[model samples]
Each structure stands twice: as C-alpha cells, then as structure tokens.
Target: MGRNTRKRRTPLATKIVAGAAALAVGGGGLVWANFYASAHEDHGGHNRTRSAGAQVATIDCPDVGQKIRDVPDRARGEVDGELATMDSQITDAYQRLATTRRAQAGDSQFVQNSILGPLKDRRKAIIDRIQLEINRAGGRADDNLDELAGCQGRPADQQQDGGGQNGGGQDDGQNGGDQNQDDNGNGVAGPVADDFIDINDVQPNSRNSRNGLAADGDGGSTGTFTTDCGVNENNLFNSDNLIAAPGVDNGAHHTHDYVGNQDNDAFSSDEDLANADTSCQNQGDKSTYYWPVLRLQDGTQEFDANDQGGGAEGNIGKILKPAQAELKFVGSQQGDVVAMPKFLRIITGDAKSFTNGDANANTSWSCSGFEDRQVTDKYPLCPEGSQVLRTTNFQSCWDGQNIDSANHRDHMAFVQEDGSCPEGFQAVPQLQVRLAYDIPTPTVENGQVQNPYAVDSFPEQLHKPITDHNDFINVMDENLMNEVVDCINRGEDCQ
Candidate 1:
C-alpha cells in the first residue's frame, strides 16, 4: 500500500499551448478531431509499434494484433495467445534497455543491434505462429505480417503529441524536458513535467447540448439507472486482462483496480463471472468494472513496488482509492435503448495511446468543481480543495450479435456525432463512470513538480494520462437488466 505522507518532487518542462479549441459539431453528433500528430503510419501495416529508446527513449514496432482481423473462431484462441507473447517480448526487451543504460551511453548502436534486433527476431517467429494458426483453421492470414516484425528505436527527445498532453502538435509535450534520464523517479520512464498542464488554463470545449438531457418526454430514452458499486475498498488488484489476453498472467504489465464482480482474472469464464459475488449493492448486477490504478509518484512503495507490473516496471508510488465511484447508465438520444447482452465486454480508451495515437483515446480529466472543462491528453491540476476527477463514457452502440470481437473493440461502437447508432448497430444503455480522487493536487513551479499523480501503464508508455483506460464485463441478471432498460425507456431515474 502507498503512504499518503510520502513526499517526492518531479521536475517539468516548459509549457505549451493552453488548450486547443478542438471540439466541434458537424453532421455527426459531436466530433473530436485529431488536433495533434498521429502515430507514424507507412510501416507496411495497419498501425505502428513503438519501443523503448536510448537517446531514442523507446522502441517502435508494428501493432500486429490490430492488423490481424477476420480470423476463424477456432484460431482466435491461439492467435490471442501469440499476441500476448508479443507483448511479453516487448516488455522483456524494455527491461534490457533500462538495465543497460550505461552500455547505451557508450555504444551508439547498442539499443538497435542488441535490444531491438533480438526483439524483432522473436516477434517474427510469433507472427509466423499466429499466421499458421489462422491458416490451419482455414482462414486466410495476411502475408504482410512479416513486415510488421521489424521494430525501431524512438529518440528520447523526439517530441510529437499522441500518448497524452497536447492538442497542437508540440514537441514540448512529454519529451522529458531537459532531463536525460527518466526523472519520473520510478525505475521506468515518463510522466515528465511536459506531460501535464494546469486545468484552469484549459478553455471550455463544447460538448453536445443533449449531453445534459433531462426527462422531457423526448424521442430518446430519457431515463437513467445508477448502480452503487463500492470502490474497490476490498483491494481487488491485478495485472491480468481476460478479455484481451485470456489465460495469460500479468498480460497488462500494469496493475488495475477492480470493482463490481469479485472473480475477474485472466482465467475467469463467462459462467464463472455469472456466479461470482459482486461489490455492487444490488446483487442482481454482477458486472465487472476495472481500470488502471492511479498512483502518486511519491517515494512510498506499494505491494507491487518490486513486482513486474509495479515498481519493477517503473510504475511506483502509492495507489490512491477513488473518493467517489459513480456508475450510471443512460439511454440514447436517438431512441429507446435495448438491454445489453449479458457477458458483453467493453474497453474504453486505448492503453497504448502514447504510441498508437489518439484515434481510440476517449479519456477525460477535470477538477471536481470545474466539470464543465475537460482535457483528454493531460492530467488536470485542480485548484486547492477541489479533488481530481477521471470520467469515462463507454460506447453505447452494439453490433447486435457478438458480445466480443477479435480486437475486443469491433463489437461495440461509440455513438456518431449525431448521437445515433451506426447502420446495423443497436443503441444500448450507455455506461458513464465518474471517479474522483481526494489526493493532494500536484503543483509545478520553477520546472519542478510536487507530488504528481499518474495512471499505471506499460513501461514503454511512460504513464501518460491518455493511455489511461477502463474495462467492463456486463453480468447483470436478466430481470435486473430488463429493469434498467425499462427505467431508461420510461425516462425515470432509478437507483
């Protein structure tokens, strides 16, 4: 556990643009356009993979899983396992980089020849196995996967906004300021002073007017249902992700705070989840909700301080429990919403947004009293007495059939700018989570940060707030799910 009294200070880089006027409405309901540079494409694949760098801070590889689509159901299990192995390969390679910092300083090509080269060879072998599994299952695997096997090193000083911090492509965002080594104090890299901005400096970005909808007898489902799931006061923490890497231990490479269903790990089957106990006050709602734990980068060491996903991997500090965890389900603005299928799983935001870009980034940060103002890529610096808030609005549109997908994202879709479900998709009750933390607000002065807070993340991600994400697996009982849908359709607020 982390001690609240621990005091540590981190330094920051110079400030960038306050906030970009990035939100706008077009024919769609609401549009958050790409205000910063996206991850490098043209790697001969769907997405680029990033790695640990020397002067180059990290590695960059191809995200093979994102490109491997339409696999036969029988092959998905083996393919998923191979994907997990690839992630492990990267983690191991990153460890090599961190430990050999001395060698990296002396040898210019040490990272490329010794670290990245070996990782690529390992990844190539795994990519072959993934393709074989799909082919054996009678699915046509893409031949270009081999091209993605090659990984490159990123310059530590190379600045471009993607992971977190910045709407206007600024090199100052997260380039580690003037420090040459990881100043985050944790053994790993990132959350440099450049990664944050004062919340009060951010201008208001307009959202949909219908977002604050009330029960006015509109065409849409105007009601809401709130579930009382106590914050993980039971201390349910783990680094496993059953949805993305089933049967794999420490797949996430970072610890998560789990709430709702008590039995949620890499091995929990749908049946196991249905029968598990829940933290929610309502026994009928056994859904599992989890997210990366937020930690203050103080000197206090927690349980995982020496573990792979914890301090060993550079995610040190004390874990802070949320002061308030409010889970509410609301209806679609277009029409009445249907009940979500049981066992439905949704992952909001990208855990690799730092390297993968903001295409899938959906996080929001604000101060408790300044809820009207929100920032997606930066952590909010709340005013004194005002707590920090992290909010996530899950995708409300379902593909109508599958409860999950190959990439764990294809089954669900966010409502379009017009606030309507896409063609062939059904609008489901949208889950909105508001998590508030009562930790001391971090302050930056003279290029130094005092008591900073960050979400646990993959070592290479550098604890970027944009990489913060959430997970949910709906296991609500049929009767209770019906009650939720009915309540929303009726425009009544029921808890």
Candidate 2:
C-alpha cells in the first residue's frame, strides 16, 4: 500500500463522511433521469457500498433501497416524476443565480420555510406510504434504528428530521417519542424547540477548534503561500452531478466539483488539467476547486405543487470574496522542508454523511460576527446580528510524487501532531475554505413542530443536520506549483 499505491482518480464525491452512500453514488448533469433505480443484493459491513455494474449507472445504497421499497410500485412512477420535477426546478434556480447577485438572504430576507412545496408534500406522503410498506414488510414507521431494514452503514441521510434512518438513536420517527422528547414520551413537540441542539452543548468541542485546524498553533517555522482566490460564483450544484472529471456522471447520491480544468471528469488528463482557465484571480492558475453548494432557505420563494424542497429551497448561494486562500506548511523545530504537489485532489472534513452520535460529526457552527465563539454539531439559532458559518480544511501532507492514489486519501495525509511531515511525505500548501449562511428556521409544523432547520445536501445526505464538507482538485500550473514548493523549501512565506 505504500510504494505500490495505484493512481485511482477519485471524484470529489467519494471522500465525504461515511463511505456508505458517497462511495456508492455517482454524479452527472440532468441526465440522471435516464437511469434506472438501484437494485441490491446483500453487502456486509459498516462501510458496505455497491458500485454500479459496468453496464448499470445507478445509485446503490442498500438502506435507501429499502426505503425505496417503502414506495409502492403503483406510486413509484409518481414519486419519480415528483423527484425529477423537483430536481429540474432546483437546477433552474441555480441557473438563474448563475449571473445574478448571489448571496444568502439577510435577516429581513429570512422567514421560516413551510412544508409546502411540490416535493415536500409528496415526499412526506411518500414517507407515509413508505411507512405503510414498512408495516407490510413487518416494520413500523416509527421503528427504532435497530429494527430498520437493510444495512445500518450510513445514518447521515437522516440527521435532523424524525424518520426511520435518523440514527440519532433517540427518535422513533412518529409515535412513542424518541429523538428529543420529555418524560411524557412524545416526539419533541416542536422542530426548533427541542430538536435543535443547543449551541452551548457543542461549541466547546468544534473540530475546527482542534489545535491543528489552522496554521500550527503549537508553534513551528511555518512555510506559507497566501492568495486572494477571489470569490467563486460557479455552478457548484453539480457536486452530486458529474464534474471535476468525466464519464461517471449518472445520478449522484451527493454532489462534488470539477474545478480548474473546465474539462475535468473521469476522462481528464494532465494536459487537459494544465490547460484550463480557473475561477480564481490568477488567470494563470488553472486549478479547479469545488465543494457542495449552499442554498438559501428563503420561504417566500415558492415552487409548483406546494413542494418546498425544490425551487422553494431557493437558489444556490455564494462563496464570500477575499477568499484569503493561504497554503502554509508548518515544519518541525528544525524547519524541515515540506511542499505539496501542484495538481493534488483534496477533500477535507467528512463529506460523506452520518448521524446518531458525536463520532463522525464534522461541523464548526458559529456566527459570522462572532467567530471566536464557534460551536459544534447542532447549532443554536444565531443571535440577532450574526449569521452561521461552516468551515472545511483539505488534506495537505503529500507523498511528494504521485498526484493521486487509488483510494484518493492515501496520497495525502493530514499534518502530524507535532506539526511535522510524516516520514515519507512532504507537505503542500493547505487549502482551508469557509462558507457562510443566514438560513431561517422552519415553520412550526401543524402548529406544533417536526422538521429541523436543514441544509440542502445532495440526495445521500438528504435532510440531515447542517454539516459542512468540501472538495479540491489542484489544477495549478506546474511552474506556480513548483514556486510554492520552492517558497516552502526556502522557508519563506509568499503570496
């Protein structure tokens, strides 16, 4: 696995949180509608995933397959139509914002989103029907995670909302009270009321607050290269779709980016990567960087058929300007050299989704105006003048030569605790990204509460708690890449 690692070109898609869903799904443009549903046989393990056979391009999650079974054959067509429609509308919203001023609506632009949307009502109805199927399958709608059918590998898709897959180990979906309930045994009466994890509860433990998150806080000679990567307003919604590289775009359970080389994908080559124009300020820098798109939860925007999940979810949001991209390599006390590869593909934070515990949760929730008070996991509603922010850091340690690895991860390792490079690995300028939002909470369902304020994740990450993740495909010029490396080797900080 060390010297013989094969170069597997990994899509930014696979490296997220739990490998269950992200590893199994693929992305593309609007062409997903041409594919068939995923069919499953038994696959075992906590990380169980099924790649489509050479001939089949479909999302294959055994758990989601079970949930799909909940949809009666009679309703399958309708549900597909409904989901497809929602997808089209969501795509259109991003297309509109492609040229318009892109920004998360401010406080005045905020309001609780209603469960009324073409997709929501149908989605909820489908879930109801799915519950009936569960009963027929000898399962209950409110069945605890233990009783849920299929693999329990990835529980991320079920984060906040009460459902069969939430995995919070607390909620029973509907009846008998689970998730967040009082002594009386009823599901938490309201959405934001009991369901939202208090800000104070998770802030002290933020992964972003971890000692090595930024430049080595523990102290060491830091070789750094800083740049203002200019805010990127590209259509990153393609995260779950095919991008970053080519050929495999079908129906992604999640999203990923194909930055730098405009022609990246499963088919991209070194030449193609070296020739693309970048979205960054450096016209000479052809590096392509991408992550999941963050959309505004503006409820005023409405979709057809009362579906809040689609166009109602609002357009794709924007990455702030002054991107302040700093690629610094912290060396040991001796100030040993560490430089990253020019065209490395990096994914930081657990992009794959999971829930039910504090184990795999990677969130640094906090207010924009109050960065020092950053919290973790469940976010408390931001105070009046503040907004929420999500941060991501990509893998930086490099093996010095191979541009990529079979698993996509082994090529680059995170910096060591002492802020030194691993024995065989050098270092690259680290890429850290932060996204901000002013998401409004959801309305009280039926005068009580049900759903939590959720971020729009690609399908596999469906309706989960807000967790931030990102992907980077380094398509920098060979000369610039070497320059950064030289700057580091000389122990100098450069922009």
Candidate 3:
C-alpha cells in the first residue's frame, strides 16, 4: 500500500541544560487510595492534620470504575452513567481544592471536613446506585464497594513510592524542569516541574530492559499491515468518550484529537460508527482512533479554552496538531494473528496514572531521533531537528468471546513475555500508534517553566505524562480485518 506524504511541523531549536542545575522537586501532593481498602479513617468531629509543615496537594480517589469488574450486560449503561458522575464529582472537588488553597493553609482539616468529606458522601451515593444496578441485573455486587467510596488527600511533602515498571519514571522528578506553583500552565492541575525530564539523560532501551518485554525473534507471523489515517487534519475534536461514558456529554473531562471515524462522541453508537465516513484511505475501515490532545502552555486558549473539557477543566493552552499520526498493525512473534471482531474497543494506558499508579501505564515518550530512550512519567524534551513522539501498543490478545468488558480492559490481554497470548486468549493483529509533534522547546529555569507542553487529562490527574493514553474502536469490515491477518501471516507489508 502506498502511503500519503505529509508535511512535518517546523522544527524548534532544542536547548540542553546541564544536570547540575536540576532543582530539588518537592512532593506532588497526590492521593493514593486503594480499590478495596480505605486510605483514611473518618474521625468524628476532630480535625486531622498532616505533619507540622505539610500541605495538601491533590485528592486521590480509588477509581470506582476500574474496581467494578463484573457489570452485567443489561446494567452496563446505568453503571457507566454513575461512574461518569463519580468522575465529575472528583473534578468538582479538585476545583474546590485548587481555589481554597488559602483556607487549606490556615486549617489543615479544611480539605477533609469541607472538601473531601462532602465529596466522599456524594461518591457513596453514586456507588449505591451502581450496586443497585448490578443487583437488579442479577449480578452479585462486590460487598466492598463501600471501600472505594472514600478518597484521601496527599500532602505536598509526602512523595509517591517508586517502582520499576515499563512506563514508570522517578516519581520525585529527575534531570530538570522547574516546578512552578503559580497560575501559569494549568495552575494546580499540573505538568508540575516534576512531570518532565530531559530526554538526553534517559538510558537507551531502558523500558525494554526493565519490563522483560523485548520481542523475541522466533517463528510465526512476521508481516505488517498499515492504515493511512490522516493526522486529524480535518480538525475532529471532542471530549465525549462513547466507550466509557456513552450518552454523557463531556464524559472524558479532557479534549481528544480524533483521526479515523468521524462520528465518535458521547452519543455515538456502534451503528453510528459503522455508517460514518473514515479518514483512512481504505473505505472499508472506519475504525476510530483518538487520544488526549497535546498543548503548549503558551497561554493561547483554543476554542474549548472555556469549555468543560478544556481550559475550564485546567486543560488550558494552544492545542498542538500532530506532525504525523502512524497507525499500523503488526504480526505476533509466536503465532499467526486472527482477525479482530468489528467494533472491538481498546483503551491503552491509564489516563489517571498520576493518581492511579503506574499499574496500567502503557505510554512512552521520546524524541524522533532518540526513540531508543523512552520515558513513561516525564515528557521528553526533544533535541533540535527531532520531534516529540508518543507511542502506544494496543492489547493484541482477545478473550475470543466478549468484544467489551466490565472495566473495558478484561476482555483483552497483552502478549506474554514469550510473545504468546494467555490461555484461552487468541493472538490478533497488534495495533501500534505513533504520534509526533514539533513545537517550540519549553524554557525551564529557576523554578519556573515557560511554554511547557503537556497532554490533556482529568482536572485531578494534573496533566502528568503517565496519564497519557490512547483509544481505539475497530469498525473495520470483515474483508479488511481478514486482509490484515493475511498480510501479517504471509510476511507481507501492506498499507
């Protein structure tokens, strides 16, 4: 298949700052609640305070949606609506926290009694509705749903625990990028100095070495199939996530750049997506591909700057269009790939990883010329002549039964270290997305950042790079899916 040529965004001069000048990053003040355990105990009337000099940072709530793994088909709609309500609750709570910083400084328990306590009560009610839906659908609701009700506040002086995951980076920040607390870029919502790292300092192949995920060059399908979906040049943008919050407007709470299917939104149904015109060159493929828009915190507000999913939610700045959006499917190393079921939805990476932990993180950031060195937590500061790259590999193993799951993830699994699907899971063509951007290099110095770049996220997630993610819904006709599998099994690259 012939590929369409695209004009890349003009390059910017990259500035390299010495590591010796790296600032000492303070704690990010994010919460850490468990899916089935309470991170705090409600004390009656008494105020609870942090250590002598500690300050409240952000609220972290155990993601109720991720915890509910057994939603019956009949109850999914109601459950999804309730879950979206919970997200909005958190967003509102975060907004209050950001605005009441002065009160928080005076009263340590202000966040608890005035903010978190109220938020918890609202979430508890929503969780009750979810439980009612599940029981009504003849599914046994988890008894511990109450545990996910309460959210905790993290302190600005307490740091996040470190881990050795593929996408995990030093939680305290590394290399350099000044942390500014003012109302500059996203203000308290983040991309804080700690969220960025100089790409030059990252070790080459560090991700593959840590996760034991290096591909083994053994047998099976060795071919590739590519789809040319223009890089959102049509300006398709929205904050509605039909997969997660169908029928709810602004469900994502963040703006997304869409490239494939034109009819995807909070109200788009399977039929709507199937009948939609696609940006892909092949008319048979109407798959929808999208992810949070990347923006430069240069103070230029885009159209949605005041809209719920944009600046109003702290996703402020001028949105940067991708220089290139490459969508391709590759064969498994250990087996022939099966055709994917149409309308199969897949979400890669955790969009709330800043507060949700790195367990579900699946994104990598790097410079075009230095792809070998990737970081999961920090936005890569690319060098001159190199563009920033965001890459994600979708799950390539299916359950062979369900195209969707309760949590939107249980139906698909990533390949094992040996490149084989888990038992009962079948190998399928892996969808790989690579997005590139060219923008002015951000200036980081003396505890301040000018013109920083960040991915849009939930108000509470703080625009952290670990929260970067991608979404896909395969709307391909049977013929296109079959061709993809055949191309991979035959060792031929087709676009």
Candidate 4:
C-alpha cells in the first residue's frame, strides 16, 4: 500500500527537542537517586523520612546484645554473693550461741569443784565473735540484694539516658519521669532503705523470732539470787548468813546440838537472849538465870527466858513474879536461888527490924524457905528455917556443896538494904530456886550447840511468873495480840 505519503523529511527542530527532553528526564532521575542515597547516609543508613506507622527493617548490633547478656551474669553474681554472706551470718549466729552457752556455765560456778570454768570462758568468747560477724554479714547481704533488685532491666530509652534518680522511671518505666514528686509538685526523696538484711528474710530456720537469751541455771550470780530465787539482796550480795544462831532455849529443858562454852556465846548472851531468843526455861529467874527484864504496862516485870538460858528454851514467854511481896524459896544448894512472886513493898518498924538487934541489920527479911516447916521441937523460937536461912547455908549454896553436882549450884541471892542490884548487874529474869538434879553436859561444837528438843515441844517445870501486876492487866488488853504480832513482824523482841 505504498501510500508513501511522501516521507516528509523529519523536522530537525522537533527531533532535537525530543532528544533534549529525554536527556533531561534521565539526568533528573539520576539526581533524585543521589539525593536519596545522601539522605539515607546522613541518617546512619536509616530511612530518615519514613512515617511513624511505616514498617521498618531491623538492624542488629553485636555490641548491644553482648552488653545485655552481661547484665544477667552480673545479677547472678550479686545473688551468689548475697547467699554466701547469708550463710556466713547464719554460721556466725550458731557459733555465737554455742559459745555463749559455754561461757555462761563457767561463769555461774555452781560447783566450786567443777573443772568447767575454762570451757565456759571459751564459750562466751565464741558467742561474742559470732554476733559481730552476723551483724556485718547481715548488713552486707541486705545491701547486695537491694543492689541486685534495683539493677533489673530498665526500659531501652531509660537505659540509654541512665535511669532516673530513683532507678526505673516515675511510671515504673511505662512513662519516664521523676517518681518521687509529692502532691505539691515538690520532689520527695525515696524511702530510707534498710541496710541490714534480716535473717528471717531468707532463712527458714532463723532464730530472730526467738526470745532473748535464756537465763543461767546456776545461782552463782547475785542478780539471779535476788531476781530468780527471791533471796534477800543483802544476804546474797554481802554473803551474809540467812540463818542466825539458834538462841537460848527458855521455858523448857532441852539440849542444843551445837554447844559451846557458856561464856561469851552470841546465842547465850544475856542481852542477845533477851532480845532475840524467845525460848528460855528460867526466863524470869533473876537470882539464878540472868536476862534483861522489861517493865510492862500493867505494873508487871517481864523478862525473856530465852535471854537467860541459851538453847535451853525456844522462842516463848516465861512469867516470873505473880504479886508484890511474895517470896519463893528453893533447896539448900549452891545454885539454889529464890524467885520473888512479885516486887517487894518495904515497910517500916519491927517488920523491918533485924534479928541481931542491929538497926540496919539484914536479919529482918522476907524469906522464902525450902519447905514450909512448923516451929519444930528440936529448934524452937527460931524463925522459919529457909534453905538459905543462915549465913552458913548461904555460903554452902555458893560453894556448890552436896547438891546435885550436875546443876549450876553456884548461884546465890542475898537481901540488900538499899535494894540495889549487885555490881555489874542489870535487871534480869528473876531467878527460880529449885533442887539441882541432872544437868546435861554442854556439847560444845563449832562454838555453839544445836537444840535437842523438837521445835514443837514445851519444856518441863518452866513457868511464866509475873513479877509486875501492871503487865498482867495489859496482857488481857484487846490490842495486845495485835501488838504482839506487829512486834514479831517488825523483829522487835517482845517479852
């Protein structure tokens, strides 16, 4: 079909324009590619212009992965260290407990002959050392655990910038910010963390919940004696004996287990016996047995027999005289002495006259005879013959004559015009004149004697004679019982 539309010779202008346009487009495309490459390079080979929602290609960093991996190892090491410290602390506590137990035993010294003293000391030392170690280890373990817990992985952004002052962020890394801010917009500091680890936190067998250390068993310590045993503080601390000497036995004839020389004995002293010893047989025996006599309110004279006789009587009252001007007499022995039933009332005239016609003669006296005798056919016109009637009889009694050799017959009594007590004499229990029989020999051991009688039995022939009438009246007073009880409780010697 050769419609050769005469191939018009192409216009040089159009062809040149078309060629230039093609060249321009190719150059522009090349410039765009270069710009893209340059942008990617600027952004560390990342798409700088990518939208937030666009999918991104991931790139791995060998250094970062290694750093992340090292974190767990560090944490594990910390935990191991903490465990080691805990073990050390537990061991120390056990050691200390053992040591304390040992030392305490030695220190107590319950038995003086025991060889456990050294062991006790060693135990104490060990306990002290263990306590110190536990304290140190506990603190260390606590710190290490806290550090490990705080080092848990933080958000990637927070890690890059170093975690906030309080470690992870305010929102717990959900949102990064200061977490310690108060409602007033003021920043508050974190809690003061505990530095010491409690054993209870980790160990199931911890003794932290146990009570304080047990008390020492032996009562060697003064503290224990007072607090535990209720012993008197003075007795425990000063080493004083709680049991004083068993004083004189009055009001009964009894034997003492611990006997000593009757002289200067603490239990047998006249003063001590009167005050402390309540048991005396011849409590009111002024002529023979001597004791401190006290005047009671009812016009009666009372004395503690226990004060007069040592270990012969238990704590009890012994009345001496019954009424005024009443005289009592004993046998004609050296130790025989008359007991006055009551205090005497001196009268004037022939009643006070002397037999030898001497105005001041001691012959005219109220006398107690050994036995009531009638004016006998053998001796008429003679005054009643008292056992100590004549001076000869008096001398014989003083010389310890044919009376029972076992009795204390050396005691004698005489009338004095002035009614003055003998030299070195004080008011004592009025004496009882009796026939001397068998007097037990003093045991004399450890400077004292023990009482042979049971504590409950009363002795024989021991009478509570009333010398002062006023004392008799007061004894029946309603408040007398209360007073006696009070005196006894107060440690007052009540005769």
Find the candidate with the highest lDDT and give its number.
3
lDDT string for model 1 (1-495, tens) is 011122222211111111212222221111112211122213243422111222455565567887777788777777888998898787667656545544554465777788888898999999999889999999999998898887766544454455432221121123422343335333336566766778778888643333333223367899999999999989988887878877667778888999999987777778778888999999999999999999987767577665656665666678999999999999987889998998898998888776666767777888988888888778888888998999888888899998888788888988766778789999999898899999787777665566788998887776788888989989999999999999999889999
Decide which is better by lDDT, 2 or 3: 3
User: Residue 220 of candidate 3: its Cα lDDT?
Assistant: 75
lDDT string, candidate 2, 366-410, tens digits: 655666655444445566655566665555567887665422456
Ten-residue region with minimum lDDT total, candidate 3: 30-39
Instruction: Kindly list the per-residue Cα lDDT of model 4 for residues 1-495, writing each as its tens digit.
Output: 001111222211111111111111211110111111211233333333121111110100111101111112223223222322322232222222212322322232321112223323333343333333434444221222122211111221222221212232221223322221111100000000111111113223221211111111132110110001111111111100001111211211211111011111212223322233211222222111111111111111113212212111221222222122121111211111222122111111111011101121111111133222211001111223322111111111122221111111112223222322344322111212121111112121332221110111111101111000110000112243333334333333443
| Full-model lDDT for every candidate | 0.72, 0.39, 0.73, 0.19
In order of lDDT, best first, we have 3, 1, 2, 4
Which has the greatest TM-score? Answer: 3
RMSD of 3: 10.2
Which of candidates 1 and 3 is the stronger one according to TM-score?
3
Better of 3 and 4 by lDDT: 3
**Per-residue lDDT for 66-134 in model 3, tens only?**
888888898898888899999988887876665554455456577788988899899999999899999
lDDT of model 4 at position 132: 38
TM-score of each: 0.83, 0.54, 0.85, 0.13
